[model samples]
Every structure is written in C-alpha cells, then in structure tokens.
Target: MLIAAASTIVLAVVVWATVVNTEGWAAVQRFFLDPAIALEYLSKIWDGFLFNLQVLAISVVTVGAVALVIATLRTLRGPVFFPVRIAAAAYTDLFRGLPFVIVLYIVGYGIPTITNTRFPPIVLGVLAITLTYSAYVAEVIRAGIEAVHPSQRLAARALGLGYVQTLGRIVLPQAVRKIAPPLMNDFLSMQKDVGLVSILGAVDAVRAAQNAASQSYNFTPYIVAGVLFILLAIPTIRLTDWYTARLRDREQMGSIV
Candidate 1:
C-alpha cells in the first residue's frame, strides 16, 4: 500500500509537471507520438521485423548445435585429447572476450573478403550472432554438465557404460535441464543483439527504422521499431518468468511428486 501510494503520488506530480510545461509536452510528443508517421513506419518496419525473425531462428539452431560440440570438447579427458581441449577453451575465451560487434565485423566482412564470396547480409548476420553466442552457450552447457551429480557418472560406469555413453546418457541431459533458464536468458539477449547486424547494413527492424527516419528526419520510426521488438519480446519474457517460478516451486517442494 505504501509503495503503491508513493508511486501514484510520483506519477501524479510528473503528469502535472508535464501538462504545465508546454515545451516538455511538445518535445515528448514530437519524438514519440507522431500519428502521421506511425502507419508509415508500421508498414515498413514489419518487413524488416520478418528478416529479424529469420536470422533469430537460424542463429538459435546454429548456436545450439555448435555449443554442444564445444561444451563436449571442453569436457574431454586423456592426454591424447589435450590439444582438442585447449583448442576448445581457446575458442570460447577468444570469442567471449571480444565484443559482439568486433566478432560481427570479423566474420561478417572479413570472411567474405578472404573467401571471395558473397552472402546476403542476413546470412552474415546469423553467422556472426551464432559465432559470438555459441561461446557463451557452450559455457552455459558446460556449467549444466558440471552441475549433474558426480555419483551419476560413477553409477553409469559401474553398469559398464563407456565415458561417451555415460556423458550422453547421464550428464548432458540433466545439465541441459538445469541450465534451461540461463539458456533462455541468452536466447532473449540474442533477440536484441540480432539488431547489431544493422552495422552490416541488413535491413532488419532497426535498419528499417533508420531508413524511414532518414527520409522524414523524425525519430518516430525508431520508436515504432522499438515498440515492435518489445511487443514480440513480452510473450517470451512472461513465459520465462512463469517457467522460472515453476522451477522454484518444484525445487522448494523437492520434486514434482
């Protein structure tokens, strides 16, 4: 009640101040509430949004597959496999340490130059997002693998399961389940970070907004693009919250049973 009362009082004061301040009212609406351009932006930005969705879908799959390989490599044992482990560690460290934009530049522009190849900008966008995000996802999967009880591995071996079988049958599954929430978090981050492909000149939502704004010299297009992203993101956000809460409840009760 106290918190609600305080928030209401603050909101009332802010609204009153805005209503009385003619300059502030005009400025806010000029940037954000331009009805004349809203429909124009809505039509153009949706085309770009579809491209964003395409890249996101492809990047998610690429990251998932590549991350599992890297995570498995990191968990390898035996002196003969030492080089493989070091290589995997180096990959994760190198990509994770670099800013996503730098990685995007390297893969998006550098690869094309080196290979004398051309891919549509959306392909480059997915590749860049996949490369950067795979490293992080590998770490998440590695943590999940580690969180599986040591005893499970021991039990699997006692039943004559090989190391590969033990890990595949026993550890990775539990790790994935344990790390689902964190993985979802990275997925959400990827949804926004996909926007960085604007640097590559892909006409995704942000790029569409930029193109629209350039013609008219108003920021309404950017606002529309942002609103589109938020609208798309909200359902996933709510699902994540509900899933996280259910996980907490299960943990507190010590299992679904």
Candidate 2:
C-alpha cells in the first residue's frame, strides 16, 4: 500500500512537471486555463448545466419506461409474440447501430421539418436522448432478464403465478440485481451525453461555453465546462465503483468452493 501510494504521487508529480516544462505550456495555460475567464463564465455555464440536468432527469425516466417495454417484448414467448420480439430486436439493433448524433439530428431537426411543428429545443433534446439510449438500455435489460435461471420461471409457474406475475415477482428482482452495475454505467454515460443536446441549439453547458468562448476568443470557458461535467460525474462514478466491488464481494462469498 505504501509503495502504491508513493508511486502514484511520483507519477502525478512527473506528469505535472512534464506539462509545465513544455514550450507552449504558458500559451496553452493563458488560453485554456485563465482563472478570470472561468470565473466570469461559471454562472452562465452553471445555468446551462442546470438545463442539462433537467433534460437528463426527464430522459432517464422516459428511457427506463421505453427500454423496459422493449425488453419485455423481446422476452415474450410463444409464436404469437414472435413478431413483437422481432420488432423489439429490430428497434434495438437499428438504434444501437446508428450514431447517437444522427439520432439527435433526426429527432431534433428532421422531425420538426417533416411535421412543420416547432418544439422547444429542450424537448427535442430529451426525446433524442430517450430514443438513442432506450435501445442500449433495452438490450442491457433483456440480457439481465434472460440471465435468470429457467428453473426460476418454472418454479414460479408451478406455484400458479401467471407470466406477468412470475416476471414481476420472481424474475425481475433478480435481473435488476444482476444488471445494476451495467445500468449504473449506462446512467453515467447518459450524464456526459446530456451535454450533446447543445448540438440541437439548446443552451446546455457546452453551448454556454461556446457562447462565452466566442466573446473572448479564449478556450478557458470550455475547460470550465469540462471541469463542471467532471465534477458532476465524479459522485456517480465513485458510487458505481463501490457498488460493483460490493457486488463482486457478495458474489464471491456466495460461490461454491
């Protein structure tokens, strides 16, 4: 432990020294690390960041609902449900294959053009995020649901539980526990991508940074925005790591020797 701590400290110091010793370091610092500029734009960027949080909050709820429905469809059995499963599978494939930027452009701009109905940029941002993330999340959820042992389902049925009841009472709880780590990872990614809504002309943190940079011709505001995002993500990142480790320990404890 001592060796590890010392090595980490040395590595950090070496990297910091290398950065500071670069020929263009001063110029880079002047442009990208200006304290005054960061301080000046912090308020505006923070306001925009609040908008991003709002979008993320809405997208998380909608994505969960949509993804659960898609996953449930994919998990349905019997020939009668084949088409539904196929449709759900196709939806996940199409969205997962397409770049999120393309989805954002389509939902944010193309839909409005086709329908001739202008929606708020925030609405479009939330919709775009939901459409894109729901696919990835649905796949994760489907995998989780399928991971449950077949015997569990059979046992539930033997006890007279219907399909929905078995799924809700017996299968889903276990699946959620298994998928919690990856789902948290997806949510972490969502936190970062929420800023992509700036491309839709929403005055999100990134857009606010862009606007501030344009006025002063310095890149410090962008750095400030990036810092803010990092700060916002740190808590979730730490939580994910802690939860993953706890889960790993629990699983190891339960495993047969």
Candidate 2, 132-228: lDDT as tens digits: 8999999999999999999999999999999999999999999999999899999989999998999999898999999999999999999999998
Q: Candidate 2: global Cα-lDDT? A: 0.94
lDDT of 1 by residue, 1-257 (tens): 99999999999898888684667878778876798887877888899998999999999999999999999999887999999999999999998999999988998889999999998998899889888999999999999998888999999999999999999899987887789889989988998898888888788899999999998788999999888888878888888888899888888895455
- List pairs with backbone clashes in candidate 2: none
TM-score of 1: 0.91
What's the distance in Å from true for residue 140, model 1?
A: 0.4
lDDT of each prediction vs. the true structure?
0.89, 0.94
C-alpha RMSD for every candidate: 2.7, 1.5
